[model samples]
Target: MPIPRIHEIMEADQRILNAFSPEKLHRLGQAIGLNDSTTVLDLACGKAEMLATWARDYGISGLGVDFSEVFVADARDRVRELGVADRITIEYGDARNFSPRQRFDVACCIGATWIGNGVEGTIELLRQSVTTQGLMLIGEPFWRKAPTAEESVEMGFSADEFSSSLHELVARFTACDLDVVEMFISSEDDWDRYVAPKWLTMRRWLEDNPHDPMFDEVRAELTNSQLSYTRYQRDMLGWGIFGLLER
Candidate 1:
């Protein structure tokens, strides 16, 4: 399992500092069709920024579940800050086994769909929370083309494990009885926004706390990742946020 990095950086000002920007958030919201009456079940909702935005701007009511204690607490605080605590509820729990007591109008498992093992598994997991006609939103990665085995390895993916074609992704969703209603593909600029800032954050942290034991490790990893990312991911892989409805 991947370590929860968001939790380690959960501060009021830095809550989503390393994540996507407000423009990206707005685009995702538009892609997911968030509206005033939409009731969302946000699985793996880190800090609940999306949920809070939906509730505050769109007047959506929903529940958000995440395993990270820091994220959950921050989410709660954010809801209070937005004065929409009544519209959203956050819980500390794993998304894999979560089953809400009531159904929702929309079920979303964003970038952290690995909680259900994969995209298909995530859809099955979310079925428990979605109403019969509700939508399922999934955020996933796809390669722009078939990547070389060495390239896949460099990106932290097993050569055969994480490699998937766009056609196969669509086929998998179709096979699972989902109709693709909409999709928002992330551009290279989006990748730049998501990844480039981490280098700066890590560099700043390392410079400020050179005496820390983990400083070298953090610096090395960030440097390596920044270098490898341009070669392996920026030119090769693409990401998308997709919305599916029952077929």
Candidate 2:
């Protein structure tokens, strides 16, 4: 199954696709000190919810780049619905190859760091798009408690897939010449909000598209996700959005 199609089915009802709430997202924008003059560059911006909401609330202008045709369309619609079309631009393309003519005041790679390979490389990528001392917002996952090799394998993750702890995650930023100014750690409630909705969405999709080519795969994926969430993810996994200032 196509990755984008899988995401489309799972997150059909979600706007901010990461394990974040609208309130927390807005608080993050405030913590970062957004204003009318702020220029932002959002990479892998699913639905562009952060940009759209910030534009409405803070009057910030920005560009959002995404690869998912489904998400790009929804993002465009979201901007228009929010009446921030004049402040936000949604671009459809590979974020890894995006080259901005002018650096932005903020650069974000929320929940989609694979565009630059991983955390370290992603920090480097975002750095190139922002002005000196600009902020970089990175949404990353970490281990709440270290899992054994067996558990890691069962989670379909490599040994180095995530930072060992939240402190380690901050250290990774410092190693790249960035300062962790602030962070918003997702609570278990946030995790539930992000994961539970997918079950219903996937089930409904399966019911309506029994004859679809990707039906079986989607069902199996959904089953695995439910099992994994119950068995390991809920307690062992954690996610956070870190605000980093270039040093």
Candidate 3:
């Protein structure tokens, strides 16, 4: 089997888990109109960074769900650290079928749409907890350009997996019967920030656990992955977080 995700090995949640900086994440949240009265439901919300940040900066109230107990625990502490514990709840659970107690003004699945299979299915899931006039937010990686067969499968994706371009991604929203309200696309620098840390973290783990059986596996995977991401994905991927309202 493939090695576990990098976060599984790290102790604390790093900042900006996805290919976006905290500033861009904040802008994306604000562009979607978050405010004190807004209630958000974030699925697969690793470390609850987005919601917790919103709660701190915009006074938004929210609930975040993730499968990682470690991440959830850290998230709860993060909320308390930011003094938004009362405004946000972080739960340890599967995000795929997480049922919220009430509808929310915003429903988000950032960089984890796989929880609902894909973008289309994730929107359907998010809609389940969205108020009538609420917004749905999804962060997905689209193709900046076509990749070779080898490049495509390196990310466990086929050529058909990603939208052809940024324009196609926008069209996908309307096809799903949602209107695009706003968007935040990541730059090449953002991609580096998100991926470079994984390399450092993994290397450190290998050094610290030289005798561990999985050491070589993790090391090889890390080496291959870093090379693949740098050679293909960094150039081919364009990740964007979109804000949508029902049409």
Error of 3 at 40 (Å): 0.7
Candidate 3 Cα misplacement greater than 4 A, ranges: 1-6, 10-13, 154-156
Best by lDDT: 2
Candidate 1 lDDT (Cα, whole model)?
A: 0.78
What count of clashes does model 3 give?
0
Clashing pairs in 2: none
Query: Which model is ahead, 1 or 3, in terms of TM-score?
Result: 3
Cα-based lDDT for every prediction:
0.78, 0.92, 0.85
Better of 2 and 3 by lDDT: 2
- How many Å off is the CA of 64 in candidate 1? 1.0
Ranked candidates (lDDT, high to low): 2, 3, 1
At residue 128, give the lDDT of candidate 1.
Answer: 86
Per-residue error (Å), model 3, residue 136:
0.5
What are the C-alpha RMSDs, in order, of all predicted structures?
2.6, 1.4, 2.1
Highest-TM-score candidate: 2
